[model samples]
Target: MEVFSEYLIFSARYDVSMVTELDDSKPEIKAVTLDLWETLLLERDGANEQRNLIRCRNLARALSKFGVKISVDRLISVLKAMTPWLLTVWEKNREVTHLDQIRFIIKAATDGSVSLREEWLDELSSAYVSAIYELPPYLNPDAPQLLRWLKDHGKKIGLICNVGRTPGFILRRFLKDEGIGNFFDVMIFSDEAGIRKPHPEIFRMAARRLGVKPSEIIHVGDNLRSDVWGAKNAGFKAIHFSTRKGRDTIAESDPNSLISISRKLGGLKEEEIIPDRTITSLAMAIEGIEELER
Candidate 1:
């Protein structure tokens, strides 16, 4: 009876140890979230400038028709003035609405000296949102294949993008027009989420919508603060996409813009925060994620 009792105790201890080991094992990766601007879509040097120009021209015409008689240069000046504010809000990881942006342009152009009638406000907002079609950003050469590969491997895909002059509706259309809209299982924009990346909550939101835990997801992007630091702080595995040359283009053509300053990895200490993997080529994305998995 004593020998039997000792054998029972050993079996119970072994079973508990096995269960604890399984519990501590890393969860399987169930989803991938990517940054849209630099990670998936590559913008040319002057696309943003051109898009704003188009908006100013369109708004000037609209204002003239509405008897407001605003000049394009006036509109340009207002936009330039707002750049600092935009950077300030973004640095705080806060977002402004598209309507508020349009209202600012009008408020600045009029110097609060003139007020447009109710109907004109709606007309002006449309002019602001529709500029992306006039001058569009191009897709990253390898983004489509990378997205497809993720889908084929049974990974849920998502996009967490920060919208600037161009808004989310237009960006969604651009994605569909570029033939990659159907690939994503989820899409989160700062304008819509009311919270931007590096906030941790936004990352958690994506994970919840993608039906996975944060630990079971990997995020890929070009920006260090917004993408890498954001994901890691939220308990996600991150892959830094550093290809600025060749086919794997990441971020805008110009990296010195003020907006880039707060988001990208310039003059920042890289010793404290680090990505689980870094891939220079989008083709090596699979390898990067696989390495993180192991």
Candidate 2:
């Protein structure tokens, strides 16, 4: 009986060792894709609202210089009005350009009453973009380190981002200035791609751009629906960066914000949709991906 018990224990330990070896021998994941806001970039409580106000004031002042007078308060209203229209575009998996957004704001605010010359329009665009510099979102302290780790390990890195008031073009410049822009092999913005997350095509698009197969790529982001569901449905492995609460404002009253929040709030069973891995900090992403590969 003692000899039989010893044999059973030896076999069990040997099997576990073999399984671990086999798991480690699995093919390594080829690439990593990341979300922009709240993943790489950290948001402050009131930074966004303050930035929006600065934008409205900047544009209003620029208009005054061009001999077109519009109240800052009216500009604020026009800006808020864009939330619904912008949300509509996003819902359809389409994105509107920055220039179009600018045109919409001016047209909606003035009711076609004040048309600026082309040069004046150029000035207004600068005024709007400059607000970000004055009141900007800070980077995640873990971002640079993770990015470096991926590069060192020879993994192709890319960005799958959704832009709000700040457009893709501006974000590229911002990332470049932030000193980590060179890490990405490709960057796809919803605005430029004309598609949003939770839609599988966007993930596939990033894979194609990086010249990698979907199965060989892993994506990390904060939103479950947008990043996890989107990447997995599109055939890529995903890691849920649950450190950030979400991009939705807690008190947001915009119809779009409400609709987005409701989906998360409305879902009861948390496990109905699950990510391949969930990490509380970006630094753990390195080990998370390794585990996924295994």
Candidate 3:
């Protein structure tokens, strides 16, 4: 079966087609685990630049109260230099929490000479979280409908997302603000779990929370490494949501990124980590689920 939309076309040309055929007769998909960023939500255009500015300004403000004054330019430079360290942690399937990030920034900026009170750290983290409001991530046009469809069909739903910059707590609040929070039966964040995706443990954690075996759930996401590779390795059917708007572009552009590293670890073959199905939009997730139900 083919599913198409104005923004996407679904096909079964690769190993995904074979996986679909194999699972066609025994559809036990009782739940769906979704990736948060890019899968269900998108950062607005120019939001990244604006958010970075807000972060620098807020960090500066937070530091001022603690008798540490720094220019936003210096703060930005320190934060930019931390990206590789952050990526290194993620590559090891661990997440650096927002608190840890704040601590690192403070240490770097102060040259390890100053110690902040707990209250000050909280103030800084709050400021960082609030910056998201400048350009909040909005749901994909199809996310609400798809989520509702899954819930109405009696399928359990969960979110297994890798947190970056914005922590899982804030993302949960964002979900509630967008009016889709109640749809998930379980929500797991990499920072909170201490294990990022492409790691089987995180997927298994979601499965345990949902009271289903990994094989009984279908994991959907826009990342091939963390989403597809992780879920498949965990024994869950997987869907590669190949939306054009998300992190896929970054992976496509950089040959040495985490996703690239993951692809290499999967034997440098696309088919080795190919998802059970591929859809271009959230709107097509329902179709992929339906095909699996067949």
Q: Which candidate comes out best when scored by TM-score?
A: 1
Which residue pairs in candidate 3 collide? none
lDDT of 1 at 11: 87
Return the clash pairs for model 1, or none. 38-251
lDDT of each: 0.81, 0.83, 0.82
RMSD of 3: 10.7
Candidates in order, TM-scores: namely: 0.86, 0.84, 0.85
How far in Å is the alpha carbon of 15 misplaced in model 3?
A: 34
Report the lDDT tens digits of candidate 2 across residue range 49-165: 678889999998998897778898999888888877876676666778777888888889889986656887678888998887898889999999999999999999999997777
Clashes of each: 1, 0, 0
| Deviation from native of the Cα of residue 136 in model 3, angstroms | 0.7
Indicate the TM-score of model 1: 0.86
Which 10-residue window of candidate 2 scores lowest in summed lDDT?
Answer: 258-267
How good is model 3 by TM-score?
0.85
Cα deviation of 142, candidate 1, in Å: 0.8
Report the Cα lDDT for residue 243, model 2: 59
Predicted candidate 1 versus true structure: per-residue lDDT over 150-186, tens digit per residue: 9998999989987887668778888999999999999
| C-alpha positional error of residue 148 in candidate 2 after TM-score superposition, expressed in Å | 0.8
